[model samples]
Target: MGQLMGFLNIERKNQKERSPLERVNDWNEYKEAMTEEGARKQAARCMDCGTPYCQVGVTLNRGTSGCPIHNLIPEWNDLVYRGLWKEAYERLAKTNNFPEFTSKACPAPCEGSCTAGFVSDPVSIKSIERAIIDRAFDEGWVVPKPPLRRTGKKVAVIGSGPAGLACADQLNKIGHQVTVFERSDRPGGLLMYGIPSMKIEKDVVDRRIRLLEEEGVTFKTGVDVGKDITAAELKKSFDAVVLCTGAVKHRELPIEGRDLQGIAPAMDYLTASNRHLLYNEPLESDLDACGKRVIVIGGGDTGEDCVATAIRQGCKSVVQFGKHGRLPDRRTEGNPWPEHPNVFSVDYAYEEAEELFGKDPREYYVETDKFTGDENGHVTGLTTGSFKKIEDGRAEQKKWDADLVLIAIGFRGAEDRLFGDFDIEKDPSGRVILADERSYQTSREGIFAAGDARRGATLIVWAIEEGRKAAASVDLYLDGKHSLLKS
Candidate 1:
């Protein structure tokens, strides 16, 4: 409550974004940072309600009501209001390990639940968060702080995505030696590869990875776990093993022509695109979207990334087929404040596509029937159908022009290779089965699973939460009841 009536006296000042026309021309972040003074005023708008639902950290109606990581929102907001930037950064770090990543990538359910947003605009929580963390780095406040002492324990964390990275970070802080294994050439799994550079430029991910290394977390890349290192070996070598392997098995559109030369999974296309951008790899037709007719299936983050990628590649046309019809502009009665509202808003990719193509690439209520290809066997076009209702099974079918197709529907579960080789029991959907009513441990003792691999594909913040929780569990398993980490 830096300013008791600050919310009433001062109108909200949101951070402005770079023009879409200018941003899409390169692979870089588009949003501009808000000023320190502006952030303080915005912080003054925090009402600091007794409940403070912006950090409620609960799930309802299949959506997040507030920040999943339970970020100390009001604390930092008040600190910023008092011009205590360093204090704000310290408060921010207490909850979130990577505000920079989340600020750029998260949908900000915290803002959705803001008291001010119930009437007018919400507190600029996301931008203010980004400002605090970015300034922390710029001021050299973010430096390596190796643990005070060693616990004489070792933990092997599989996968280098957010969950793995977060788990490694927590374990290291508690003085447990941690090593993260990644199959790819780079360390960050989704953060470095799955997400496009336009949303969060590569260097941001790299900066964090470098810091993690400096803090004593070992990163081993280009080493497949199940193949190069066996589960038996990990269990024998390390005191405990935490599996942070994300749910990466993509749900496929296995219709006819799926085997065509140009048809590939969303990850393959995205990974290839990311590799090209980060490593300067040669791009082939299937991997490149430049000047080709591009059609993306599924309308989630992956699909949006494909649309953004295609636009940046100078594709002839971009079309996204969303199985569900276009969402309402405003939240429906079913989606009240504090819950993640199911409403329509343009993302960075959508804005870029709109500016470049003169129309939004999304075709709602559309479903793919089958893909039709040219005589040469390379993908050329596909068939589609419309859905009158999301529950409706049938609609009018038609053919659409497409040279490249990216399927971004969603993930099924973890890949069969890594977990399956452990001889671990699996759920009906192939996810590693947990032990008992509440457990991160699997049928195999000393082995624990967290994040998407356990709960299926979820938000990034949720992944970080799972990692922290699992790391605590792993510490308990290692150091018994005397350990400081939460069980």
Candidate 2:
């Protein structure tokens, strides 16, 4: 480390964010860049523990703790502390294919497991990572590096989300001819549309896509695999096929009056908002949240995004409902250090809503009972109830106004249409194209799966790891030897 006792000398510092009042009025990112000196100081706070649990990506007792991709955290932190920007970036890129995206959107499990966080604040790892990548981009060090030799093996990756893109990038780097198929108009799947523009700007995604294209990866956008091109054709044409479609089917609240108008899914709403931002097009009929009293039914990231978007679209008002009670401000008993603490958090969207609405928009311990509709069958309001889990594991509901209801209760699994079309065997969870950890090969010979479609809706870091592992498996399957793809 550059400063052996820097942690004792300096307090932790992070990037300043735009004030709630100022940032809510625009769609730009709320976080302001920290100066290079400030970033170095923050990096110096890394205690660099003996075990370094932050980089030990593993789950114990069904609880996940550290970075899923197992990033070289302390190495890069030391490099950053030493003002070795390029070296820091190199160490970061060694494991993470898209540090910029993960830095912006990941929940920062690494920080949660940081040794410094056992007593005091954790090092600002995400902010330092973002700074390193942004500096790399600014210095023109981030550029296309095509493989020196071509393996002449073709690989088809379905879905261009983080997992699929990471798989394609890894395979292409190893000199395999890789092509990515995306159903949307753009290359990035969830990163392009499901996420709001304010959190991670679309330009960041586009910039990386451009670089991948320059590196000779082919992208076929607006092409549905099963519909436009059959799975049989893909299997026959490409040396291998990797499914990374992601878990996208939104779980619905199937209570009475669910058929009423003005009730939509969270992905639909986010997709429409992003489309409007990207293409200047009118909002889709089933997706707009404008000029209505909106009630978001879930307190996760998607629900927070709904609150922010409704406020931006001039909704009459917005509120979020969570079935679980509000989490404690700090870690609780049995939730010790190095585990991802289930502590309360105020995200950027919540801050925006608080500034605009004069209060936090979240209502915890609440569950939707039913929806109320107007004469024209439009959603007028909703009936909700306070839920409490009893000793016997039953929910006791106690009945609250919902005019527009959004079911952001998360996804169950990936859509089954493509899996069925390909005759791919699924796991008990109905996830597509099952494969063992060792082989990453499907029930069928050359087919494979990775990312959410293979696992479930997980962190981007996990997706990248799966992609790299799947690439190695595919390489070994093709050439009878495994390459340096992190498997």
Candidate 3:
């Protein structure tokens, strides 16, 4: 601890944000950088605890208890507090391959398990982390350090998301020639298109992809594996193949009139809007929510993103529906302190929606029944039923006007289109069948699976962890020795 008992005197203050009224008018990051002094003060609030649970990454009761990548939080906090910016960056780089992505997009499960939060507010760890990485880049501390010698083994990574990128990065650093294949014109599977710019600007994603290219990772875009090329050809061309295709098959809202026009999946809507913003292309008429009464039918992070996107698109009004009731203000008995406390707070989208519409757009305890359409098959309104809770009975149905509807329900599993072509065995739920409990190797010897393909839909941090471990497994298989690469 750089400053003993500093937690007693310091009050928690997170990073500032642009005013909602001003920020909603443009597509830029809502958060502003924290001052050096503010970040240092926040880092100094780290308490001297013998057991640092913040870095003890694990799942308890099916909830994340800490950082999944096992970040060295206390060491970096002390380094930042002592004004050793470069040292902090070094420590951060040892664990996380991309702090810039996680600091902006991740939910920050590390702070939920902070020991300091037991007595007072949790340390602003995410803000300090962003500050360290940003300073490192500004000082030219981050540069390409590719391996001096090549191992003469070629590896193919089949997706360019966080998991694939991390696996490729570790393998390239360890002297293997790695190539990444992406179906889209650009890399970064979810980060490039699925997420809105308000959360993380596209330049940040591009900056890392460019860095990877400089470090000896070849990226081939606009090439679908199962369609453009056969899986058997890829297996013969590369020494080994790693599958990182994410869980992208969105779950459907199979109510009546699902075939109606103006109803679309949330990912499709986001990808279209992101393409429009980045490439200046026209948005599909049904996907565009401008001047339309938009209704998002799922209450999750993706739903929130839809709400924010609709607001930026100049929607006449927006509303979100969640089947469950609102969360409690404080942690319940079932959710303890270090178990990723399940509580309620106003998220950025909610704040922006409140600022623009003069009320929160979320309607809790509401479930969609069916969609009503006009003569042209365009959605006009929807029927919803409200209930106090799941344990109780449902109330009478009510009608709400809606011009566009976005189904933001979560993903079911990975797309099964390529599984049969690859000759890969998949579980009934569509996840790849691994050889064993502790291995990343699939039923096929040369092919390995990681990230969402094996684990279903999960957090980005877990995906990175899966990728690192899979890289280690691949390295061991290739060289017939224990891998030195960190997992």
Candidate 4:
């Protein structure tokens, strides 16, 4: 530890943000980064706990309890506290291929597992991480480091989301000729389109993509691997193919008026708005939530993002309904510290809504029975029934009032076309079935599936870990039994 008893002396002060009212006017990231001294002080709050649970990366109670990538949390914290920004950045980059993405988007299970949180506030791990990486970039330390020699083996990575990008980055670093295929007009499958710019700016994604390109990773955008170029042709051309297409088949809300004009999947609505903000494209007529009474179903991160998006788009009102009743504000008897704390806190969108609308826009234990529409068949309102939470934790019914509805319950699985085209078998959930748990190989040889495509939808850190492990597996598969790749 950089300073003994620093945790007792210092307090946790995170990166500041622009006020909710001031930030909603534009689509830029509202975070105001701290100075070096401020970040160092925050880093000093890391307690020197032997066997620190923050970096254990264990699955406790069906969720990750710590950093999934097993990042050297203490090492970087110590380095940052010592004012060694370069050393901190190096330690962070060693485990995380994309700290910029994870630091911004990850829910930070590491904080949940922090020992400090048992008594008082947890260490500001996420803020310190962002500070380290942002400093590295500003100091021109983050540069393109292409491999010295090529392995003479070519690999094709399908999709340009975090998983695909991490896989491509790793394979390229290890001397493989990697070409990433993206179906969208721009690269970054989810980072560019699925997520809003306010959470993570477009330029941040573009800068990382540029670095990947400069490091000899080829990117082919606007090329659908399974559609334009058949999977058979791709298999013949590349030595190996890794599928990180992501779990994107949004779960549909089936009921009466399911086909209403004003109801759309959360991803489709987000993508349309993202494109409009990024490329000056016209937003789809049905996708816009401007001046509409928006209703978002599901209380996950996607639903929260949609709430923020609709608010930014000038929605008349917004309400988010969660099937499960509200979680306890503090940990319950079954949920304790050092495990992934399942406590509830008001998230960003809800806070912003509170600031704007005088109260949190949330409903608990509610179910939307059906959508109601006018003669034109457009969604005007929804019927819901409210139920009291009991032993079974089921929803009965609730009331609803909405003009635009976003079904953000969750994703079912990956798109079936790519896997089907490649003759890869899918599990019952529609995810590409892996050959073995250790290796990310699919049902077919010379092919692999990682991230959400192999496992169900997971965290970005887990996705990166999968991509890294899958890259090692692909390297071994190409180089034979005695392959020296890191597995």
Candidate 5:
């Protein structure tokens, strides 16, 4: 609203990314930051629309329409446009615990639901958000602000992913002594390992982890809760326990030859690569794609990450298979405005694959039949059948050569065995049975579950929202009265 018809006067420009050919050679972040002026101009494009849908934060027709955490989009856009970088960051931090992570990795349902997008391009909300947070860090505005005093109550948060971290951060801010436990070597469960460095550099994840440590959140790495520490011991040690353990039980292709030597779960592949990159672990000792023909089964962010990781590892060739047909170039009639678009566009990994291999690596509408292995017990290739529709007759099966097959199909629920020691009820799908939707408390008293553990697999933003709500619920349960902590 700073400029009259700012939406009409300005054009949307995204941040520049490193050239695919060059970026594929290293594990550095791909996207570059936008100039301050460019970001301000982009913020000005947030038109003065009544009922800003960009922050509606609702789900319509099974698709998210806006920001899941309900960021104050217009307020910050105006602040950025007026060159109030600090104010913008303040407004952003009010709701989002980690703007840097979201701005870099979130799919940006906010932009998809922007009122401006009804006619013209949506405002560059993600870029402006990134600019504000990155500037805040550069100016040293983001620092540890521990609570004025301790509340004497202690909370134990299991897992160190976004949901767990957010839950721990909120509780710590409210004066509760919070301790986070991660089963992995690093504290950041998903951010540090699941996501490739090209999307979010390791330094960014480490910076936040260090800040949390400085703010009085204790992190215990390489500590498996069920095995290393018993449920009875944890209950006796902490006043309350919050399970933020994510849904990491990967779904497997139960078809024949699934046990082949070269086949591995997508998360294992990504985790191995990231560990090798950060900890200098021998890639060959785990799952290395070097000089191998890689095939990624299933599609989505995980599959894209596999493709990008393989490219970085100097794979001979890579291909991704999706059982569904290609999405339309434009939104279909059913997917209207305010809904996250279901249209097709090239993602970074696809673009990089095309640049290096001279062709897109996506093979849609293909269903894998079975794996074919050589006598040495190593995977050689796989057979896939093409389908025009879900019920249609499949075309003749075709064989594709692949030395390594990464299954990115998706996750089920949390690893049930981890919670077996505790007498907590879970749904048939393995999700913890919450006492109620209003309270994230699990079946047992003083125990709560959030994020993927309660909701199954979901976006990081939703996980953050779940964590905040769980924190508020926990605070109420602990105080036995109205809690000041915001959900």
Candidate 6:
């Protein structure tokens, strides 16, 4: 470690955030960068544990424990502490192809497992990571470095989300020709659309896309792979195909008046907001929450984001419903240290809601029974319920007023249409292009699956990890040699 006693000497410092009152007025990134000295001090707090559990990516109890990408957390922290900014960026980029996205959006699992977090706060790992990458860009240290030679093998990667981008970047680095296909006008799948602009700016995604293009990864936008192009065509045109399409099928809340005009899916709402913010065009539909009493069903990051977005859009009022009971602030006995704790958190959105509404908007242990609508077929209110767990069962019944209902209950699986058209075999979950953990190969020969399409909807870091692993498998399938993408 740089100072050895740095953890004792220095205090943890995180990125400054915009004031809730002011930041909620518009859509923009909330967190401000910490000063260089502050970032260094935070980096110095890394104790450099003997094992470094923060980088030990694995599954515990069927969930990701540490960083799925197995990022070299302590290594980069040491590099930052030593003022080796470029080297820190190199080590950071070696594992994560897109730190900008994860630094901004990921729920930091590494921090949860941090050795320092057991005694005090974690070493501000996420903030230090953001600083390292931003400094790298400012110093002009990041540049396009195409592979020296071409392998003459071409690969078509479906979907331009995090997983697909990471896969393309890795394959391109190893001298394989990579082309990413996106159905939307933009290249970044969820990063470009599903997420609100307030969290992650679209320019950041565009900048990375530009870098990938410079690095010889081609991007084809507005091209539906299974529709405009066929699976058989891709198989014939390219040596291998990798499905990186994310789990985007929004879960529906089917109840009375569910077909009301004013009710919409959370993705549809967020996507419209993003498109309007990014492209200055009107939303495809009039789905704004403005002036309406917005009721966001399901309490997750997505629902919280809806609260934030609705506030910014000047909604009359906003409320979030959670079927689960409120969690404790600290980890319980079942979830001990080194495991990502299932604890209650007040995210930026919640803070903004509290500041604006004079109270937290979340209502826990509640479920929607039915949607109440006016004669014009527009959502007017909602029938709600409180749940109580009985012996081997659960029970509920209640009601409330909700003019605009946004269901944010998360996704079920990837759209089967894309896979069905290709005749790709799927799991019982109806997820695209089945494959094994080790090989990541699909039922169809020379085809592979990774990320959300292979697994399920997960974090950005997991998607990146899957992309790297799948690229290795694809490389091995194409040529008898192993891929250098392995961490």
- Kindly provide the TM-score of model 6 when superposed on the true structure, using C-alpha atoms: 0.97
- The CA-based lDDT of model 6 is what? 0.87
Work out the TM-score per prediction. Answer: 0.96, 0.96, 0.98, 0.96, 0.97, 0.97
Put down candidate 2 lDDT per residue, 374-405, tens digits, no spaces.
79998878776567644346665544355667
Give the Å shift of residue 246 in candidate 4: 0.5
lDDT of 5 at 337: 96
Colliding pairs, model 6 = 381-402, 384-398, 384-399, 385-398
Query: What are the per-residue Cα lDDT tens digits for candidate 3 across 1-487?
Result: 9578887788888889999999999999999989889999999899846888898889998888889898899999999999999999999999899999888888889999998887888888899999998898899999998999999999999999999999999889889999999999999989889989999899999999999999999999998989997899899999999999998889998999899999999999999999999999999999999999999999999999999999999999999998778899998999988989888889988999999889999898887889999999999999988756456765768899999999998888877776786788886655544434466888888798888888888888888988888888888889887655545
Give lDDT per model, in order.
0.85, 0.85, 0.89, 0.86, 0.88, 0.87
Q: For each candidate in turn, give its C-alpha RMSD to the true structure in angstroms.
A: 1.8, 1.9, 1.3, 1.9, 1.4, 1.7
Model 5 scores a C-alpha lDDT of: 0.88
- TM-score between model 3 and native: 0.98
Clashing residue pairs in all predictions, respectively, total 0, 1, 0, 5, 0, 4
Candidate 1: Cα lDDT at 298:
93
lDDT of 5 by residue, 391-470 (tens): 76557678999999999998888777756777788876555444457788888899898888888887888888888888
Residue 373 of model 5: what lDDT?
93
Q: Candidate 3: lDDT of 390? A: 56
Instruction: Note the residue pairs that clash in candidate 1.
Output: none
Per residue, candidate 1 scores C-alpha lDDT tens digits across 1-487 of 7688777778988777899999888888888889888888899989888899899878889888888888989999999999999999998988787888998888888998888788777888998998898899999999988899999999999998888988899889989999998889998889888988877889999999999999999999988898899888988899988888888888988888888877778899888889998888998778888889999999888899999888888899999989887889998998888788889989888988888889998888877888888899988889887776446656687899888988888988887776567777777655644532244787888888888887788878888877877887888788885353332
Instruction: Report how far residue 218 has shifted in candidate 2, in Å.
Output: 0.4
The residue-level lDDT of candidate 5 at 368 comes to 94
